[model samples]
Target chain A: MERVISKVTFDLAQTSLRQVNHFLHRELNSETPKITLLNPDGAHNLAVGLDATIDVEIMGHTGYYTASMNKQATITIFGNAGTGVAENMMSGRVHVKGFASVSAGASAHGGLLVIDGDASLRCGISLKGADIVVGGSVGSFSAFMAQAGRIVICGNAGDALGDSLYEAVIYIRGQIKSLGADAQIEPMMEADYQTVGELLAQAGLSYQPQDFKRVASARQLYHWNADADQEY
Target chain B: MCGIIGLLIKQPHLRDSLGELTVPMLIGMGERGPDSAGLAVFTQTLADPYRKYSLYSGGKDFPWQDLSQALQTQMSKEAELQPHGNQAVLTTDLPSTTLKPWLKAHYPQLHVLSTGRAIDLYKDAGNPTEVADRYHFKDLKGSHVVAHTRMATESAVTPAHAHPFTAGEDFCLVHNGSLSNPNEIRRKLEPRGIHFETDNDTEAACRFLEWRMREGDDLATALQKGFEALDGFYTFLMGTADKLALVRDAFACKPAVVAETDEYVAIASEFRSLAHLPQVKHAHIYEPAPEEIYVWNV
Candidate 1:
C-alpha cells in the first residue's frame, strides 16, 4: 500500500504560532507528511517541539529558536533564520537555504544541520552530538565547548575555533584566526577524509576533503590539575 | 539587547529610497528593543557651503524659529531652522566649532545631536514605529543611514541615551553591546576637553574614536586602537561622510551580519533585518570576523 502524504499550510501573519504548533503536534506520528509555513517575517519560536518524522518548510525569514527541539523531522528554511536555529535537536535534518544567525546549532544531541549560506557567531556551541555542515564561513567562537559530533566548514572559520572542545571533530577548508583551549590541528587521515567527504556529499557540497584541516581535542584541559588551576 | 541597521546605497537611483528601506529594517527588530529608536541619515550636501547641526529638545513646540532668528542676528549670516518631531536641524554659514560653543552656552535646554555637512540625526524614547512616524522618516531621502533600536542596558531610557552617537564632524556610531570600562575611558577623555552629555557606554566609545581622529589618527587606525583599548562584548557599525565600517570584539559575543549587492551594502544585527532588501537573494552575505575591521567607502 502506498502511504498517503498529507500537506498543511500556515500563514503566521494571519494565524498564531501556538495554533500552528498545536496543529503540527496533533498531526505528529500520523501520516508524518509535509507542512508549509508562510510569512514568518522574523517571528521567534516557530515550528518548535516537533518529535515526528515529518517535513517542514518555512517560506521566509524567521527569528530566534526556529525549528528547535526537533526529533526525526526534516525542516527546511527557504530564507534566513535568526539565532538558535535547530537548537537542541535530537535527530533528523534541518537545512537553511539562506544565512543563519548566532548559536545556529547549540547543544544538539543528534541530527544533521546544513547551512547553505554563512552562519554567524557560536555556530555549534555545546553540541553533545550532531553533524553540522556549513557551505559558507562561520563566525568566531564556533564549536565552543563541543562534546561530540563532526562539524565541517567548506569556507573560512573565525577566531577561537573549537574552544574547550572534547572528543569532537572539526574540519575547516579556509583560514582559522586562532585555536581555542584544548583544540589542536590534526592531520586528516584516510578515515577522516572518507568521513568528511561523506558529510559534504550529504550536504550537497562538492569540496575536496584534502583541502580541509581536521581539528580535535588536545585532552590536556579535560582533567583539572592543581598547577594549571593556579595559573588561572 | 539592541538592533543596529545600516544601509549604504551605491547606485544613484536607490538613494531616494534609503529612508524608506531603513524604516522597516529598524522596526523588524522591535522585539529586541522597544524602549527607544534613533537614526542618522546622510544626504546630499546643501546648495551653499554650510554646516548642519541636529538638535533635540525634550519639550515639544521648541522655539526653533526664535533660535534661528537669534543665530542669524548673532552670527550675521543666513540661518535656516527645519523641525521634525522633537528634533530640528539648524543650517548656517557659521563654523561648527564656533556655533557649537555658542549654542551650548546659550541654549542649555536644547541638546546637540550631531553636526556635519550632510548628516542629520533624529531620536526619541518610545516605540520604534512611533518614533519613526514622529520623525516623518518616510519623507527623508539620503545616500545612507545608520539606525538603532535600544533596549537600555546600562542607562536610563532617555533621548540622550540613544545610539548612533555622533563622534566628530560626520562620524557616527551605533552599538549592540555594553562596554565593561566606560567610566575609565571617560575619565581619560575628559582631561582632553572632550564633552559628554549622557552616561551611556556607547557614548564613551564614540568619544574615544572622535578623540583619536582629532589627534590625527585615521578611521581605520582609530578603530584598530579601539580594539586594544575598549573592553567588553560589542558589535559596532560606524559611519563617516564617505565610508561605513563594522567591527566586533575578539569573542564575537554579540551578533552582526553584512549583505552586499551591486546596488547597496546593508548590515543588521540579524539576517531578518536584511531579508527585504532589494536583490538580497543574490546578495553576497557574510559574517565579519572578530577584531577585524570591514570598511566600505562610497
Candidate 2:
C-alpha cells in the first residue's frame, strides 16, 4: 500500500481533485491497489473512470458524482455524498455511510450501489443494468426510466414511484404514494424475498424481506404503441 | 444570493463584459446584494498574457519606485507591457461619467476602481439593468467576466465599495464573503501607500489583491494567497485581462457551481441561472472545495 496522496502539496493540492482520476488512469499500472486521501474536502469526481480492481476510501463528505463512471473498483465514502453519488456507474460497488441527495444512482449501468441512509429524489432514474439498495426512504421520481437491474428500498418511498419505468425491479417495505404511469404493485414471491434479503445485507440494512412490498414497471412505457400513444 | 458568472473559451472570442451578462442575473437576485455591484472582465490583449496587476495610485512615493513600477519594469520584456502609451493621458482622460459624484454622495469609501485603459466598472444601488443602462455596458465586451451584488452586513453601504474593484491595468474582483483580518491586512497595505475609501471587508480584499499583484503574483496565485491569509467565510471571483479565478474560504460555507463542456465553462451560485443556457447538458453542480482556488485562462 504505497500512499499516493498523504498530504496536500503545491502541485497535487492545487490540481483539481477531479483530475486525480485522469492521473490515476494514466500513471497507475497495477490493477488492485489501495489509495487514500488525507484531507478529503468536498471533492467531486474523485475516483471516476477507474477500471482496475482497487479499494478507495474517502474519509470525508464528498460533493457530487463521487464514484461516477466506476468500472471495477469498490469505493466507500465515510460521509454524506452530494447529488448523483454513483451516476453512470458500470461495475463494482459504491457504499455511502450517510444520506445521499437527488439522483443517487442515476443512469447507472452495472455493479451495486448501497446507500446507508436516506436518498433524495430520482434515486435510480434512467437506471440500467445496476442494483441499488437504500437503507431508508427515497424521495419522489425514484426508479424513473429504469431499463434494467434491481432497486430495493428498505424504507418508505416518496410520490411518483417508478414513473415511466422500463423493466427494473423495485422492492419497497414502507408506504408509497401514487405510482408512475407504468408502475404497479406486485406480490413479493419467495425468490424476491431472498433477493431482497441479500441486497439488504449488502447495503448493511437490518430488515426482514417479507416486511416490504415489491413494485415494478409493467413495461407499458417501453415501446411506442401508436394505437394508445398520446405523449411520453 | 449574490450572482457569480465565469466564462472560459478555448478559442479566441469576444467576451461579454461582466455587466452585460451579470446585470440580468443580479436583477434576478433582486435586493440580495443591493448595496453595490461589481464585475471583472478578462481579455487576451497581448500575445502572451499575465493575468493580474496591482494599481497603487494614491500611495505616497517612497525612496525607490513603488511596487507597481518596479514589477512592471521587471516583467516588461516578457511579452506584454504595462500601460505605457500615456499614463498621464489615461489619468486625465478618466471617463466623464457621473459614477464619481454618484459614488461620492452614495458610497464614500472603497474607491479603488482605476485600472488600465480597460477594466471599467459601473455599479450603484438600484436594479442591475439600471446600472447597466447607465454605464452603457451592453457594448463593452471582453473575454472573461465575474460579477457580484453586495448586501451590507458589518460595513457601511456605499457605491465606492461596490464590487469589481479594479487594482491595476486590467485586474478586478467581485466578492461575496467577509474578511476576518481586515485590520491586520489594512495595517500592512496602508503604509505601503495604499489608500482605501470604504471600510467594507471587500475593500480589504481589493487591497490584499493589489498587494499580492505587486509582489509579482498572478491572479490565481494572488487568489491562493487570498484564500490562505483572508479569514472568514467568502466566495469571491476575480479576473485579470486574461485569467479568471474563484476562491473559497476555509470553511466552505458559501455555495458555487462550475459547469464545463467542449464549448464553454460557466459558473454561478445556483444551477437555475445556468439552466437557461442550452449547452449545459450534464453539469456537475456542487459546493466549492474548502480553502481551494480554481483558476482558468481565457
Who wins the DockQ comparison?
A: 1
Which ten contiguous residues of candidate 2 chain B have the minimum total lDDT?
B84-93
Report the number of the highest-lDDT candidate: 1
Model 2 spans with C-alpha error above 4 angstroms: A1-232, B11-23, B43-112, B282-286
TM-score, per-candidate, Cα-based: 0.91, 0.48
Clashes of each: 0, 11
Compute DockQ for each candidate against the true complex.
0.46, 0.02
Displacement of residue A169 (Cα, Å) in model 2 is 29
Alpha-carbon error at B189 in model 2, in Å? Answer: 1.7
Candidate that would win on TM-score: 1
Candidate 1 ranges with C-alpha deviation above 4 Å: A12-16, A27-29, A154-156, A171-177, A185-201, A204-214, A229-232, B47-49
Query: How much of the true contact map at the interface does candidate 1 reproduce, as a fraction?
Result: 0.37
- Supply candidate 2's per-residue lDDT for B188: 85
**Candidate 1 lDDT, B36-131, residue by residue in tens:** 999999888765558888999889988888888888788887888898856899888787778888887888888889888889999888999998
Indicate the residue-level lDDT of B160 in model 2.
61
Could you give candidate 2's per-residue lDDT for residues B154-255 as a string of tens digits?
Answer: 776555666767654566677766778888888888899887767777778877897888889966677778867888878787776666778776444455
What TM-score does structure 1 among the candidates reach? 0.91
